[model samples]
Target: MKNLLIAFLFNFLCLCVQGATLDFAFQLGEKQEPRLDKLLPDVARQMAFSRDSKKLIAKGMGGTVVKWDLQSRQKREISRIHAKRWFVYSIGANQLLVRDADDNITILSLGSGDETLLTNGQYESGSLSAEGTLAVLSKGDNEVEVWQLAKQGPKAVKTLQTSFPVRNGLTLSDNGQFIAAAEGTYGDGEGHRTAIEVWNTINEHPIKVFNTGEILGVWNVLFSPDATMLAVDTQKNAQSGIRIWEVETGRQLLMKSGFEAYWTRALAFSPTSDSLASGGEGGNLRIWDISEGESVIWETYPTGIQSLAFSPNGEYLAAALWDTTIQILHWGTSHER
Candidate 1:
C-alpha cells in the first residue's frame, strides 16, 4: 500500500509538469519579408500593423513612414516629412499620427491622405485610445492632455497633472475606459520610480495609482483583454518585470520577468487574457502566464524587438523588430509531452 501511494504521488507530479509544459506551444506563422537594404536605411523606431493584421506601417529614422503589404510584399512610402527627426508616433487602419522635431502633431487620413494639425505643443509622449476616440499627449514636466478625435479634427478634452516628469510611454485600454501612463526615467536618477495612474474618462479623475517606490521606472503599461488587470514594466535596478494589477482593487496579483535586463519596448495582452507577450532589448520576446507568474514561452532573434501584437483569436502573435523585419508566430495546440 505504501508503494502504491508513492507511485500515485509520482504520477500526479508528472501530470502537473506535463500540464505546465503544454500551456505554451509556439510555432512559426507568416513571414514578413521587407527589402531592408533597398527600401529604407537605418532602423525603424515605430511600427503598427493594420487592423486586420494584413499590412504594416513603419517609421524609419528620417521621419519617413511606409506602408507594407504582407500578402503581396509591396512597400509604399506614405510620408516623407522633412523634419530633423520625424516619426510616425501612432498608426491605425484609417489614420496615422506623425510627430516632428518641432513638436507638431499631424493627423493623416490613410484613405484620403488628408493631413490635419492636431497639436502644435511639444509632447514627450503620446498614444491613441484603442477605439480611436481619444489622443493622449504628454508635454514638458508633468502635463498630459487628452484630445478628442472627431470627424473634423482633434480637440482637447481633458488634462492631467503629474507629480514628476514622465518619460515616453503611454497606453490606453481597448474599451477606452482607462489610460495607463508610465511616469519615470530609464537610467539612474533620483526620481526613477514607476507609477500607473488609472483614470476614468467620464469622471476625469484618477481611480488609483500603482506606485513601485524609487527603484523601478515604468517603461510601458498595458491592459488585459477584459480590462480587469494592468501590466506594467519597471526598468530601474537593471531589472525588468511585468506586474499584473487588479483594476478594481489595485492589488498586484503577479509579477514576472520582462525578459532579462533589456527595456520592455512593447507589451500585448492575449485575446483570451490568459497570457501576455513582451518584447524588449536583446531581441528577446517572452510570453508569460497571467495566473501562474511563469514564463511559458520565449524566443530570441538578431534584431531588437520594438513592438508586439496578438491576434484577435489568440492563435497568432506578431512582432516588429529593429532589424526592419516583422515576424508572425503561430501558437500551437497544447498537449502532453
Candidate 2:
C-alpha cells in the first residue's frame, strides 16, 4: 500500500508540472502585416487613445497637444500650452489633461478649445480612469490622491501615502476604482528594492503590495482592460521579468521572461487585454500574446519607441519613435506561432 501511494503521488506531481508548463497555442495570419507608419510634427512626448478608442491624444513638440481622429485620419489641434516638459493624456472624448512643468494640472476641452485649471495640489505622476470620472495622482510628499474628475474640479476623494517616494508613475483601473503605484530603484545597486501597491481608489484604502525582492527598479505598471490582472516591469530589460498579479485575490498569476533588452521602459496593454507591447532604448518593438505566451517583433524604426498607444478598438497600434516619427501598425490579423 505504501508503494502504491508513492506512485500515485508521483503521477499527481507530474501532472501538476505539466499543466504549469503548458504553452498557449498561437495562430498568425499569412499576408497580414503592419499597415503603415505616420510621422507627426515635432517630438512626441506622450500618446494615448481616447477612452472609446476612437481618437488619439498626443503631446507633440513645444508642449502642443493634438487630438487625432482615428477613423477620419484628420488632426485637430487641441492645446499648445508651453512648458519645458509635462505629462499629458486624454481625459475622455471631450477633454484632455496636461500637467505642466510647475505640476499644475489643466483640463482642455476639444470641442470648445477651452482650458480648465485643476488646483488640487502639487502632483508628481498621475493616471486617469477609463470613464474620465476618477484620477489618481501621486505627489512629491509620498502621498497619492484619488480625485473625482467628472464632478467639480479636482476634488480629492481618497488619499494614499507610501513609506518610500515613487519611482515610476501611477496606473488606474477602468472604473477608477483601483490604483497601482510603484516605488524603488533597479540594477545590482545596494539597497535596491521595488514594491507595487494596489489600492482601492474608490474605497480609499490599501490592497496588496508586491515586493519584487530583487535589485530591480520597476519602470511601468499597467492594469488589464478588465482590471482582473496587473503587469509590472523594471528597467532591467534582459534581466527584467513581467510580473502579473491577480487583482481580487492579490496573488501573482505568472512571471514571463525573455524580454530583456536595452531601455525597454515603454509598455502598453492592448485594448483587448489579451496582449502587451513595449519599446525603449532600441528601435525594437515587440508584441506579446499574454495568454498565448508568444511575441511578434518589429524593427522598422531607426530609434527606440518613445511612447505607444493602441486604438480604442484594439485594431491598431501607434508608436512614437525616438527618431521623431510615429508608426501606426495595423493589428488584429493573427498568424501561426
Candidate 3:
C-alpha cells in the first residue's frame, strides 16, 4: 500500500507538468497581404486599427495614408501630409499626432485636415494614448510633460517627475489619469538596474514601481484597458522575457522567456483582459492565457512583427509584420486543452 501511494503521487506530478507545457492552437482565418512594398513607392512604416476593428489604416514613408475595410478586404488612399521626420503614433477620435519638418509637434484632424500645434519645440520621446485624448512627452530629463488633447487645442496639464532617468516607450492610460514609463539604466556592472514607474497625474504622485532585475533593456510597456494590469517586454541574458504585473498590489504575476530581445515590440491585451498577444523577432505570434499562465504559439513568419492589436470583441487579432504586410488571425474552435 505504501508503494502504491508513492506511484500515484508521481503520476500526478507528471500530469501537472504536461498540462503546463501543452500548446493551445489558434486558427488562421485569413492573411490580408497588402503587398505595400510593391504597391506603394515607399514601404509602410506603421499601421493602426479602428476603434471598432472594422477598418485598418497604414501610413507610408512618403506621407500617404491608406485605409482598408477588414470585412471586404478593400483599401483606398485616404490622406497625405508632408513631414521630414514623421511618425504616426496614435490615431483616434479623428485625430493623429505627427511631427513636422521643423521638429514641431502637431495634431492633424483626419476629417478636415486642419493642424493644431502641440509643442513648438522638439521632444526627445513621446507617446500618445490610443484614445487620442492624452499625450506624454519627455525631454531627456527626469520629468515628463502630460498634455490633454482636444478638438479646440492642446493644453499642458501636468508634469510627472521621476526618481530615475526616463527611458523611451512611455505609455499613457486612456483615461488620462495615469502614466507608465521605463526608468533606470542598463550596463554590465552590478550598479545597473531597471524599473518601471507608474504615476498618478491627478494627485501628482508615484503609485507603483516594478523592479526588473539584470535586464539589458525594456522595449515596450503597456497598460490594460481596465488599468488593472501592466505588461512589459525586456531583454535579459541576450533573450527576451515578458512580464505582467497586477497594478494595484504591485505584484509580479507572470514571467516567460523564449523570444528574441531586439524585435519583441508588440504586446496587446484582449478586450476582456483575460489574454495577451505578443509578437516579435522571427515573426513568432503567441497568445497567453493570463489566468492560467500558459501560452500558445500560433505561427512563425519570415520576418519580425512590429505591432499587434486585438479586436474589441476579442474574436480576431491583427499582426503588423516588418515586411509591410498584415495578418488577421481568429481564435480557434477550442482554446482549452
Any residue pairs clashing in model 1, and if so which? 63-86
Residues 1-337 of candidate 1 have per-residue lDDT tens digits of: 5534542343233222213321222212233443434423434556656667666666665566777776676778876553223333233436776676676787777778878889786676666765567777776467678789887767998888775565646666767777777776445456555666777767666798888767556656678868899988766557666778999999888876535755787787777787777887666667777777777765555546766766564455667766555665655324412
- TM-scores of the models, in the order given: 0.78, 0.76, 0.78
lDDT of 3 by residue, 90-129 (tens): 5456566666567778777666777788886666567677
| Model 1, C-alpha of 44: deviation from truth (Å) | 3.4
Model 1 worst lDDT run, 10 consecutive residues: 20-29
The global Cα lDDT (0 to 1) of model 1 is 0.64
Residue 81 alpha-carbon offset, candidate 3, angstroms: 3.2
Q: TM-score for model 3?
A: 0.78
Return whichever of 2 and 3 wins on TM-score. 3
- lDDT for predicted candidate 3 compared with the true structure: 0.67
Alpha-carbon runs more than 4 Å astray in model 2:
1-41, 51-54, 69-76, 83-93, 120-122, 185-189, 237-241, 257-260, 296-300, 333-337
Q: How far is candidate 3 from the true structure (C-alpha RMSD, Å)?
A: 9.1
On TM-score, the stronger of 1 and 3 is 3
Please give the TM-score that candidate 1 achieves against the real structure. 0.78
Q: State the displacement of the C-alpha of residue 305, model 3, in Å, after optimal TM-score superposition.
A: 1.3
Q: Which digits, one per residue and each the tens of the lDDT, describe model 2 over residues 184-270? A: 753555557778888876554567888776535766688887888888766443455466778899776666555545446567877
Question: Which rank order by TM-score, best down to worst?
Answer: 3, 1, 2
lDDT (Cα atoms) of all candidates against the true structure: 0.64, 0.63, 0.67
